[model samples]
Target: MEFHYHRTGPSPDLATIEQAIAQLDPAVLVDADDFARVRISTVLDEYALLDCLWRAGVQVAMGELERQPSVCCGGCGG
Candidate 1:
């Protein structure tokens, strides 16, 4: 529905991202496959996904990443 973002740094208390994100771009890349473990499914519901994030001690707002193509597509950009 709506887009929201929050930033968390080395120290969780000092992390703030909502002010920085007025509008979210689904195509935006948060990390470059570095300094991170695991990833989110693009097609998942934003709210439900946030629940998992909270259980893992992570905070999220709204909006979700774009869909990722499955590896079986033979690179056709499916």
Candidate 2:
């Protein structure tokens, strides 16, 4: 799932966010818009990712951000 993390002022550095994402369970960053926004992919349930971000000093907005559906087909028994 994707989430939008907002900051009070200037966005945090990439390294900082990356460090935080690392703490979460299998949270992979898909993309980011400067330091203000970020897109992530994770398999954690119950919004645990948000908790990780919060602990990392990043405030994530409520609700999961929407992402375009993937069209790539990679031999999934299709």
Candidate 3:
């Protein structure tokens, strides 16, 4: 899955975000722009990565990320 994040104004360290992405498994730092645009690919622990970005002073674009659809039937709970 792909994830996107951005920050207001400018961003300080792409290196820091890169480092965090490196340390976080199942996550890949796809691309980061100087204007504070970030793209990542991961199949696990997305929230953890988002938190990491938040701590790094970046804002996550939750709408850009794909959400898992509900497994329940259209008219049934199960």
Query: What's the lDDT for all of these models?
Result: 0.37, 0.57, 0.59
Q: Give stretches of model 2 more than 4 Å off.
A: 5-8, 64-78
Which one wins on lDDT?
Answer: 3
Candidate whose TM-score is highest: 2
What's the CA RMSD of model 1 in angstroms? 11.1
RMSD of 3: 8.1
lDDT of 1 by residue, 1-78 (tens): 222233445423211222122123243223223343323333335655465445546565444333344544447553
Tens digit per residue, CA lDDT, model 2, 1-78: 444544457655656656666766444664567655666665544357667667667766556444435443767642
Q: Ranking by TM-score, best first?
A: 2, 3, 1
lDDT-best of 1 and 3 = 3
lDDT score, candidate 2: 0.57
lDDT of 1: 0.37
